[model samples]
Target: MALRMNVQARLDHRFAATYNRFMAAAERRWAYESRGQLLSGLTGRVLEVGAGTGVNIPHYKNADHVVLVEPWPAMRSQLHQKVARDARVATTVVDAVVEDLPFPGASFDAVVCTFVLCSVEDSYAALAEIQRVLRPGGTLAFLEHVRGGWLASRVQDLLTPVIRRFAAGCHPNRDTEGDIERAGFTVLQSETLKPLPVVPWFAPFVKGAASPADHP
Candidate 1:
């Protein structure tokens, strides 16, 4: 299916600082808690999509080999710091986005995605690509922000225009979990809960393995 998410090139050179600060502030509070849960669930030959600055570094305990994707050039400086001199997550970075993923099909045992679908140009397609590349029964774990209650949903809809402009394509209200379902995976377990501070809406997530593969 052709997706409408590639609306424009929102990843430009101008909003780098704004994105950096926004993410740095987001990390300490609610995000840290949510991300901690997601990372702990990851295991075995994990492939992390959109691993910005390797923020998921410390939580990468289950992995002996971890591959990450981060295409943005602007975030690389901060990302390097997260890479660290001896980080726990032994990381190899992929300089590309989801749609143009560089790995072969059925190449991963697991995939990690956190707070990433909203900014993706075509998140549904990206999920399909993830499902395509992962071995059947491979785990797909995510912690993302998406459309929620009617009140916050309305606010997210209204703010999306301006939010996308200033926040380097971050969207407050994309129905990310819905798209994951459509991509041919069964959600093994999920939870919907709110993060702290002023951030509105619930953080709905799915951490599950897919269907069994057809063997020849």
Candidate 2:
């Protein structure tokens, strides 16, 4: 896993450009499925993780503050451009990894992540960071693609080894919800949605949050 993480960190830019292009198509699908779901997912001081190109800016509601954390430099540049053209992106944007957030503990009301975790080397570590920065009980809303059941996992296992070498370490069979659970977060609500093109079982991500009950 550490080696795989290194591979992803190394190929960040090459993947960023391609990822940015396909994002529009993915967002179109997400819009059909999530629509106001993304909007409803956001509230109060928010932090959108791996906020690639800021596709979520328009989906967020009015808030006192909003922060976007994206590490890929190429994507960060594009994210800046996306923000410049928008009027509501009057908040801060940081080019940083989620594993090392630049905020204090319990600083936000919600954390938003959309279509960004598929490539994270350590999704669990990133989730821990999200949990750390968010105020107790603060919601962590996200849209992510993860490993499907048996057959899909078997296929992903075969293709993943090949894909990572060329596709920027993106995994097609990561059990995202399970990883989130291992990261110490409760799954509030979730579902299996439509599939993506080329890649089977990858589309219209499940939306869920992780906050402890009566969180300390």
Summing lDDT over every window of 10 consecutive residues in candidate 2, give the lowest-scoring window: 196-205
Model 1 agreement with the true structure over 48-155: per-residue lDDT tens digits: 888776677778877878887888876666566777653686777678898778889988888888877887878878887888778867888877778867788888
C-alpha RMSD of each candidate structure in angstroms: 4.9, 3.6
Worst 10 residues of 1 by lDDT: 207-216
**Against the hidden reference, what TM-scores do the models get?**
0.82, 0.84
Q: Which candidate should be chosen as best, given lDDT against the real structure?
A: 2
Per-residue accuracy of model 2 over 1-216 as CA lDDT, tens digit each: 999778767676677777756556756765434735655446689888888776677666576678888887887888888877763735778978888998999999988776667677788788888888888888877667777667777887778777766665566677777887777777787766655463564633566666744472
